[model samples]
Target: MSDTLGAAVIGLGMMGERHAQLWAELPRTRLVAVYDIVPERAQAVADAHGCLAASSLDEALAADGVDIVSVCTDDQSHLQPCLAAADAGKHVLVEKPLAITTADCDAIIAACERADVKLMTGHVCRFDPRYVACHDAVAAGEVGDVVQVFARRNNILASGLRIGPRTSVAYFLGVHEIDLICWITGARVTRVHAEGTSKALASIGADDSILSLIRLEGDAVGCIETCWIIPEGSANSLDARLEVVGTEGRVAARVGGEPFEAASASRSSRPDIVYWTEVHGRVAGALRDQLEHFADCVLDDTEPIVTPAQARHAVQVAEAIHHSLDTGAPVDL
Candidate 1:
């Protein structure tokens, strides 16, 4: 192992591409290989990054100098690649909600544990400065005796059309808030009652929106609103916010309401500046910070910021949400 860790990324979707690019761009890691279900996609990314286009997951993990693997596959398909990466003795960084099911999350976590390698689930919001600042304030006792939390993560109609069929909006978007609420408040979700409605994505047999009322371990309550039916013409593709109210004070963080905007004759847009954005020809923002954090953790042999257990908790809550939606009753964890 040199000073820099070598990286491999499986899956070549939008998020996967970003992972590959960041691995190539970051100082502590360099892209060594990339693999995708589609050979052409893998080849394209490898060509652009000057890395190996692995023909299979085995090849990607076996590539010379590959020390870390980024499992950027879809919500449901995370288990296999993650297990393979761990078995190959490489560190793993997977995208959230970790997996659509708690069982899969556990399998991945166990595999990494057995292999004695680090595992991190990419709950990118934790790396966001605003979210981090909010968490810090809460931890510092600025928010005394948290009583309630409210989170909203709404995306454009295009997102629903693109991802609704593959997975529900709750796992795709709601999990971020689920994890954040528990992390910021330092309480586990004890119960969840959820309801969903579908119209725009009904044709695809997917819910257009889901609202969940959650009770934390200390009787703290939370409301989570996740919808993917916002019009694409909206200035931002994503609109998200989180607020924590306590007996002494309240802390809140807002996303998608960025001050910077660009307008042409046809439309105006607010590009994401916090999550994944280009600055001076390189990837910058929370996602980059997240990747760097994982690399540094692996290099230093320290625990990742987003532990496997914490990530699994988010998946467990998501499963409970779906169960509540199915039974039309509250599901106690």
Candidate 2:
């Protein structure tokens, strides 16, 4: 690879466009090619970034001078593009929920290992400033031995469609808190008790709300509440609250309206949502930071921040949550 890494972005949706924009501006990366199932989307992004728009994944994979690939496609379609990148001897940075299933995640991990390629998942919360500050505070014992945690993610109907009806709230929003709780406390989830209900948007076959309680390895417990019941034309939003009650004292971080205000409102307003402010601005910055970190890891042969094994654990927890909902019983990990 040259001093500037030649990067290709697969999938030109919201996430993909962010990646493309970041690569265009990143000093260490160059946008060589972009591939999307939708040609117009691909061309629009590519033209804006001054990059080639590949007609197919194979073309993107075979494009000359490409050394890194960002797999920004949907959750279910992550495997093939990642495997192709690994086979093509390119480093890969895949978006989160590594895959829809554990088996598929395993295959991608195995292929990357066998091919000696670096693979990093897009658990961007690990890089978020607020989350980073909270993690540091907890690690420094500012929160003492975290005994309990409460987290929530809620949004309006428009934002809910991003995850789609086929996927559960646990995988889409809960996964971030799962990773956060684990990362902050440095513990593995031992068991999960969960329940879900859908009073709205029944057309998508998705739960309108979900609540889960997780027991960690050290007996510390965490709770997650996720809902997609915010009405249409409402502000797009993601509200999260983290309260860590420890042996000494408690520390909490919140990113939404106050409880009283939230209670008064029918649903969260858009003012709370902060992920995609300038379309490609924040997310693109995070994606660039993540991919650059992965590139450094590949160059230095170091372990990635979020390893495949960790991603697998996230998926396992998600599965456990789903199982708990189905069996109406706490599922042991």
Candidate 3:
């Protein structure tokens, strides 16, 4: 076998393009194939990465030498291709929420386990330095027995217009915090209470914001607040914050700071200072780091930092939260 791993990307949207570029650039990974429901999009990515534009997902999965598949499809459409990849004996790196339903997530997990293939969810927040460092602090006992947490991911209204129609705020925006809070505290969410409203995005029939009160094992309670109704003219694309209060101390983090700010006649805004930033003409920061880690783990035959089971649990929690939103009551997990 070659030292480099052969990879295929399914889905040619923004994230598919990113994954294609990362596969081509990673030290020991080769971008070998690309696929999408749209032929032109697949061909565009294939041409850019110097790979084949597979006629179908099966062709991509069965491409000679391809050992890894990156599933970048929409949140609700992740299960089928994942199962196909597992059947092809290919390792999978699926973009989060994993799936819209816990049963689908469970099927993906079980298929991968039976196929003896590794599966990792793309919960990029867990890989970000801001959140990763905080998680480490909590795990290191610096925060000493986390008792409470609060996390928020408020995006500009543009996101509400673009994404809210396809997925809920709970799965699309709240999943990050759901996964991160659990990862940091190493606890299972045992119950959830949530409320939501859709007036701001009524035209699209989508929820504008949601708040979830999640209770975890060991009695550690957390809040997940997600809103996609930030005005288009807001200073930043996102308003995100995470805080964990422990018995002995607390850790807080926010993605902010950059020397760049634009104050125009009509509006004002600030450039993002972290996560994925273009530097010296290429993508860098936590996005690249996470892809690097994925490729490295594949090459070294090691377990991923984010496992299928853990990702499944995150989906379970997100589903419960959605149920709570619907029933206007608490859900016990």
Candidate 4:
């Protein structure tokens, strides 16, 4: 067995809690400390995982045993914690849209490189079974000369109310599909034209939704649509799907379905059929797989499957989309 790496979680939001849980659960990992701006949240997470609640980011990075840090902070708050961890010589697994801007992404990359530590962005959709299969099929040329791609990720207002204040729908929901389209097609986005509407979320300082028309350096064209204004009556939190078309064939998948469903007078919902689920009474799925990949890369000294450069490019594309939204013109990338 590989030596277990000690881990620290730097945030205690919903996603941060998941990271702490998995860090403790992984066979070659140990949760050593937790940190959050809110001490109570940090303490609660630390208590749940039997680890220390660090008083600050520095304390967490300097913890006696932590060799890995998971930066699960808000979209705009990822860079500082990442830089601290890298400077402290800890491998980092930062949640996606690594930063709100391209310059910040570049800075994190350079800092980690200088410190000689592995830096990973949490674009976990690439690790999802459905997306993984799509990538494999494309690699095998099953799709044969990719021609077009259509992807959609929409969600109910409940999630938007929480997330939209921190980042736009494009970065919050569109970044995953943006990364996936580029990952599978093996093409960089050369130009982008995007339009966003602010019907429901305008008052919150972000668009309710966005649609981007993307031009790849290669021949394939893409349209990625993301909206978070779905009604409360919706059956699921997300209405997500991905479809890729080519000369010889096409592949498509609906992102969320239910292995179980339930209803009450208040509302109805469908639990995830895949991604993250309790398998035999424990957390397991692509989220775990993504973390495992990061752990393995750190333990074995393998290159990350998702490079920092690619993660930076996704941020660039997201920025370009927002620029387009502002100017009503497509920005060449």
Q: Rank by TM-score, descending?
A: 1, 4, 3, 2
| Clashes, model 2 | 1
Predictions in order: lDDT? 0.94, 0.81, 0.88, 0.90
- Give lDDT tens digits, candidate 4, residues 1-333: 249899999989988999999999999899999999999999999989899999989988888889999999999999899999999999989999889899999899999999999999999898888888888998899999999999999998998899988888888888998999999888999999998888788788889889999998776899999999898788888888999899988888777656578889987789775767888866898889999999999999999899999999999999999999889998998
Candidate number of the best lDDT? 1
Inter-residue clash pairs, candidate 3: none
At residue 294, what lDDT does model 1 achieve? Answer: 96
Model 3 spans with C-alpha error above 4 angstroms: 256-259, 262-265
Off by over 4 Å in 4: none
TM-score of 3: 0.96
User: What's the best-to-worst order under lDDT?
Assistant: 1, 4, 3, 2
Instruction: Give per-residue CA lDDT, model 3, range 94-129, as digits (tens).
Output: 988888888998899999999998889999887788
- Model 4 vs. true fold: TM: 0.97
List candidate 1 stretches off by more than 4 Å.
Answer: none
TM-score for each model:
0.99, 0.90, 0.96, 0.97
Residue 207 shift from truth in candidate 1, angstroms = 0.4
Clash pairs, candidate 2, are: 235-270
